[model samples]
Target: MAEPREIPEGPAHERVTVVLITWQRREEALVAVRRLLELPERPRVIVLDNASTDGTAQALREAHPRDSAGGRRLDVVVLPENQGAVARNTGVASATTPYVAFCDDDTWWDPGSLERAADLFDADERIAVLTARILVEPGGVEDGIVTELRESPVQGAPGLPGPALGSFLAGASVVRRSAFLQVGGFSRRLWLGGEEELLAADLAAAGWELCYVEDLQIHHQASVLRESTRRRRNGIRNTLWFTWLRRPLPAATRRTRDLLRSLPPDRTSALGVLDAVAGLPWLVRERKVLPPHAEARFAALEESQRTSKSRNYSR
Candidate 1:
């Protein structure tokens, strides 16, 4: 067996577990797991397989037999049905760590990034999610969207360890376990793409702060087969759903109009908008607006949302 990476000693041996959500990308998932296993933090890892039919469960078990038994080991949870973000909730339930770092099947955390994230949570009481700097692969370039996070237009108090973020990138963030359970993990309805926004808003409403940690890093090598068009559709739909679910009526109406006007005059955007409106009956029944202060934060991010290259509704 290969010797594990050297981990930093902290206040005792606090475990930090990693939960990676995977679908059909078996090879990419294996590579990511390999890198994660090499992290200096030596996190207990779990791969949440969302009913993948491509032999992912078999591959994982075959590749890491010893990682499955005795000691603090890697566990693979295979769901019979596709539960989307709820798969993450199951993975979190299975983790025994005070912190859980989420990584996508195609992404990997830096050497000691998980430990640093765990340290931040250990030191702070108010911080719920510590979002990391995401760099794209091979050439190792900064994801352009990261620039927006770094120079976040949202105003926060001086005492904050990092910039206050309106939303988090799930694949590149470390979340405190207790806080995550308190606010509930990602939404089941939002499925995969851009699912973090609604949850972030809810976490803030519950008085937990989400911060951008510059020191921790996660690398994303976007997979070639990712269904980008469908992801775009879901992003648009989920954005609209979030707008209706929590924003005040006037704010929701205005935001909906703005989204409509800004969207391309094509069938895709049309379907996205229509899908959102189609769920209006439930949206109205479940509507719960944020308090004025929380609403203000959402309002403040509107202009950035309008201008961001990351806000595109198309792949």
Candidate 2:
């Protein structure tokens, strides 16, 4: 690991604050915080420790005992219980900066990338979300989803950094704090896996632009301690709820059928479907179809989503 360097206090450094959520991953979270503090931008960081029994909160406090070199504080909020992805909502609420970048326990933004992201937000007032090119750690290879983001079929409007996107990767994205709050953060109902899609859709519906910026980078070292099967289950259930909540009747039906067809014949898939069915009443009550333009963008991505290797539910 590189030694922590002093960061200059400036407008760029003050533009964004990072919000990371972790559960039980104490060592990984500490390592991530160290790398984040070492960034040249030296943005403020807040870690939401979701009631980890592993002393993650204590480790984080010990790791960042003082403010960053840029004079921004590293704060930690230890929740009473595991709120899953909703823990990010608390972190975002605590942020004083205009932009909030989401990070997982196993991920960290690259040096200067937060500043670059802030520049993009400064350039475009309508850009609510800016997703970075994620490079997996160790080999530093581009994430499989990076290809999908790069080849996004959505047409980009003038002045945006890269292609337009209908959805964003929360762990690798920076968002306007106000816009994020206005539309609400991640859904508590969706929990963690694949939670970004619902929030992204709501942002789009409110006329906020989401874009992919290749220059901004994030490093993700996927943690070994993960509940893959449970994650896949939640992801599938969330997808179903999102489809029913936002897509038109025909589109929703078609998507649900397609998803069912694609899922492997297993107990997990069956349980995911059952869980989705159990939520139908609530989903119906909250369902609001996307506008024509936003729906069209989602429609354009169906084929790509179906073919995406990164989105597979197989654990």
Candidate 3:
């Protein structure tokens, strides 16, 4: 593995680094990286390629060649195997900046947003994660999920930029590197879909605050190169795993029952349930219920989550 790139000096470089993960979406990844590089913040970016069969690694290298002076604006790490969301953890581990902004293959931060996020982190030491308002591409309309984030039922502290959040969307959030590492980053077992919740919960439990900042924005094109059914399956399975891993027995049982009732009676749903059940032994061994304060925050968001249009399991 290459050594983590040094955060370039001078006012030209932002104190934030972008950590993007891509798998098989080579074209989208290139577009995202190009857009990120065009930002005024000039943030250093690390791309973690999860063993793409396509020429994503070579394409990235060609697009952002290392400078002959031994300085680079971009660094690409091509893993031998796909590690799913854990690839972001690897990218975060390789970040030298105080803050890391995560973007998916089809997402890019809006210009000046990274600078604003860095300023927010600098202003509040307790703030660990700041989720940006996501706008879909083409027409640049606000994503449905942004409404829930903006109207968060969870209460905010005095210094937060917006409403406090019980969880954050990993694809559009900037996080304090130290706090993320302290919480051990994303869970390897959960892999990819809906993986941010467990880490967000742990951060809250550790006394770090997460908030939604309307001024900051991320653009997501929602790549067509995706496995919708597989994503839905993993998402359902991971949600169950997380509920069992962190919620109290009563909450977990209720959430589990609700999930089962809501899921479609199909092969994908069956497989997800099977996968979740297979992980019960590990969940039983590692279960640590959230603190009352954090649990209350989660409880407040339950209604919103249940009614969310952006969180549907269907393709």
In angstroms, give how far residue 126 of model 2 lies from its true place. 1.0
TM-score of each: 0.93, 0.94, 0.95
- Order of candidates by lDDT, top first? 3, 2, 1
Q: Model 1 — TM-score against the truth?
A: 0.93
Output the lDDT of residue 18, model 3: 95
Q: Where does candidate 3 stray beyond 4 Å?
A: 1-14
**lDDT tens digits, residues 68-147, model 3?**
89788999999989999999999989988889999999999999898888877777777889999999998899999998
**Which stretches in model 1 have alpha-carbon errors above 4 Å?**
1-13, 67-69
How many clashing residue pairs are found in candidate 1? 0
Cα-based RMSD of candidate 2: 5.6
Instruction: Select the stronger candidate by lDDT from 1 and 3.
Output: 3
The residue-by-residue lDDT of candidate 1 on 122-167, one tens digit each, is 6667778889999999879999988888988665546667898888
RMSD of each: 5.3, 5.6, 3.9
In order, how many clashes per candidate?
A: 0, 0, 0
How close to the true structure is residue 63 of candidate 1, measured as C-alpha lDDT? 80
Residue pairs in clash, model 2: none
Evaluate residue 296 in candidate 2 and report its C-alpha lDDT on the 0 to 100 scale.
79
